[model samples]
Target: MSRDERGRGTLEAHRFYIGGAWVDPIGTERVTVRNPADGSVIGTAAMGNAEDADRAVAAARAAFDGWSRTGVEERLALLRRMRAAFDEAAPAIAAHLVREVGLTTMVAEGQSAMCRSHFDGIFDLLPSYPFSASDGGMVELAKEPVGVVVAITSWNAPVSQMLCKAVPAIAAGCTVVVKPSEQAPLCGMLLAQAMDKAGIPPGVFNLLNGRGGDCGRRLAEHPDVDMVSMTGSVPGGGAMAAAAAPTIKRVHQELGGKSANVILPDADMAEAVRKSVFGCMMNAGQTCAAPTRLIVPEDRFQEIAALAVAAAEALVVGPPDAPGVTYGPLSNQAQFDRVNAMLERAIAEGLPLLTGGPGRPEHLSTGFYARPTVFGPVPVESFLAQEEVFGPVLSIQTYTDEEDAIRIANATPFGLAAYVQSADPAAARRVAGRLRAGYVTINFPPWTAAAPFGGYRRSGNGKQYGVWGFEEFLETKAIVRA
Candidate 1:
């Protein structure tokens, strides 16, 4: 019943924005959205079914020819307008994230700003993008849109993930049908409003809200969908890949990760441990590339463990609106339950709990809040060290030597990201070079918008951001002429 700055009273989740207009969903089933901060009903959205997916796919397919033929200036103009609209709506978007996704205002603001940054980054790259090239006059190479794209984004980063997929696809002259995560569909709706305000052509950009099993599966299997781009769980990506296989459509996934942060023997133990702890606790440890596994020297295990425990205890966990709260609740009851179950399993297996464990903070009685937890002297092969908890949980493991550190860092099926800390910059870079991950940080590099990001191995394939991201939606065709 709350009203936004624009006087809109809660998002009408019962509607889906397709072909530049808000339309009612064919399905009568609705999903009641709840605020994890206090478990209050924030809103409700129509749970789209397979038929809605079909209609969206059909709209995108129909728009492909015209959108793909749009001149660069025209596309750039549209993107500029979209970015401006997004900036104007930033406060509302951030509010939605804070309410629906349990993000603190500070974190939510940064995430909301990232939506504009995605468009701005692409805006800077578009003019210089080599869409067509000539090779010695005999052969010409043309980069063209891949056609209708279905973008499936994750709940942890709904706004950024959606923009990351949709902006690049649109910039590459492809029509897109975006399916935002059901857990945080409101952010997607706000972004769609921005797009509508930007005057994007009908059918060029579409939005649908629904569960992955029904709408997502249908979109992946649809013959009209030229490519499937997803940022979600590994099982979800695998399902999309399998469903898209029958039609042999291109599939790009940014899936899960159990990333490692290695603190070399030469590093400042206290500083390294503190930074790693804070990094793991960011976003309530819901980030896919979070350094959840801390690989430290065996001799310094006690010192590292103590520092980690102190760091975890220092984090202020409370509701999103609480004064000076550094972290908030898990986005939903399911995640809260999952984190508690993992903690229980760890305790049962006799893993040492360094700081917090197995419950909500003592102050809060009813919410999805989980204590910032730390575990130490954990074996590299232990469940605590090998899995993506996606909570404010940290697992500290010991390594005998530098070689051992690298091996332990690469031990998991995931290779999304890795971190190396050392007083010697050269040493840190050396270890970074050996990591199998797509992205690595040596003592933490400055965040850059143009840095290509994705993963290696089971972490998922393809790259995003800057030129690489823009190219993901494009196909190369070579023409020979004499």
Candidate 2:
């Protein structure tokens, strides 16, 4: 379809950005970006082959020598400019994310908030890094840049993940090669433009538009790339780390999650159920850190389950750009189908559907839409409860008491994030400490940018954002005097 015919301008398919310029994809084929709202083609974007990934990697290697050696002050100044550029372009970026990814404006705003916050937080922590240190009359240690970095980000919160890796890597004086998810690559291209406007040197921050299997694989496996950081599926993260292993490059991954919300018996059932549904169902539950499983008191099962169902029923799922929209369409068809299958399996397994079950909303039949699903008394071993659905599905399981709640919350193999809602702050803190996860939101506290974010166990390793994030791009060397 032509741009004029569609009324939104012709979307170009197959354009890759390398060394500050947009070029045609090296591959012959292209991928289409579909609006989940109606399953209509929004535009076509580039899908780079393995060969194209190599070319991007070569360009990144060539630029890294100069960019990595540049002084910290120079890099910081450039990032400051980039931050300003982002501020000026905030509205456009936010709008693009909403239209392309089918996220509510509030969620888009959250992505913007994360992007701006990461940019500002990393800069704040840069001055504190131990770039050079001394102990007595001898040199103690020095943290040096690790050269070229390949950062692969997921589509759920495109800008948020990109900034999580890119901002800190830049702050540590490392040149970056970003491979954004094909599902939402336009945002990456726009970010490249912002970097250029910020006066960043060519090749300093290169963006490649391509699929994960081909372009992303090559980038992860390239020998010239010195380090890799990715945020996506656990399998994807493992593959990237394995690809980087032969070259001995540092691999930092933040992957899949099925976080638990442990609602203590002492906690208010109304408040706990409210936050659990909203948190898990936010972004259509596409977030890696979303608390999808709720572990509540078994005795209070009926009470909390009813409240959760009410919350889900109250949610207004519609087009992202629509007024008063609470939830948006799933990112793609695959996610939509997966959610439906899981719901069906839950029903078949005898789990009672507290609120929404499956299928598209009756009103909007075209786009990927799954009713907000909530299940109570679900078996912990069920795929719907164990696996990461990455959809607007919440599984409610009841527990005996605080001890049982923590046990259920800690049952998941993925430990990315956890949540606890309690009337008593001390009790919440005590529970938070015991949960084996990277982050815990007590009473849904404001997500802080300066806080360190990563995962434990199968969730993947290495921190992102703040000082810990910046350090991932640096290699610490110790010197001892005779």
TM per candidate comes to 0.98, 0.96
User: Model 2, residue 394: displacement in angstroms?
Assistant: 1.0
Candidate 2 per-residue lDDT over residues 1-482, each given as its tens digit: 23332124445645666777777777876777877887676678767889888877777777788887778688779889999988877777787777678898899888888888887886777766668888878678888888889999998888878878888887777888898988787777767766778877877787878888878888888888889999899988888888788888888989999998888777778877887898999889999999899988888888888898999988889998888988999988777888888888778888887778888877776788778988878777777778998998888888877787788888878999999888888999999999999988888888887688888988999988778888889998889888
Question: lDDT score of model 2?
Answer: 0.83
Q: Using lDDT as the measure, which candidate wins?
A: 1
> How do the residues 1-482 of candidate 1 rate in per-residue lDDT, one tens digit apiece?
24477423465567888988899998778888888988777788888999999999988988899999998899999999988888887888887888889988888888876777788888898988888999677999999999999999999889899999999899999999999988887778877887889999989999999889899999999999999999998888998899999999999999989998999988888888888888899779999999999999898888888889988898999877677888899998888999999999999999988889989989989889999999888887799887789999999889999999999999999999999999998899889999999999888776677788999988899998889888899999999996
Whole-model lDDT, model 1: 0.89
In model 1, pairs of residues that clash are none
Name model 2 segments beyond 4 Å from true: 1-8
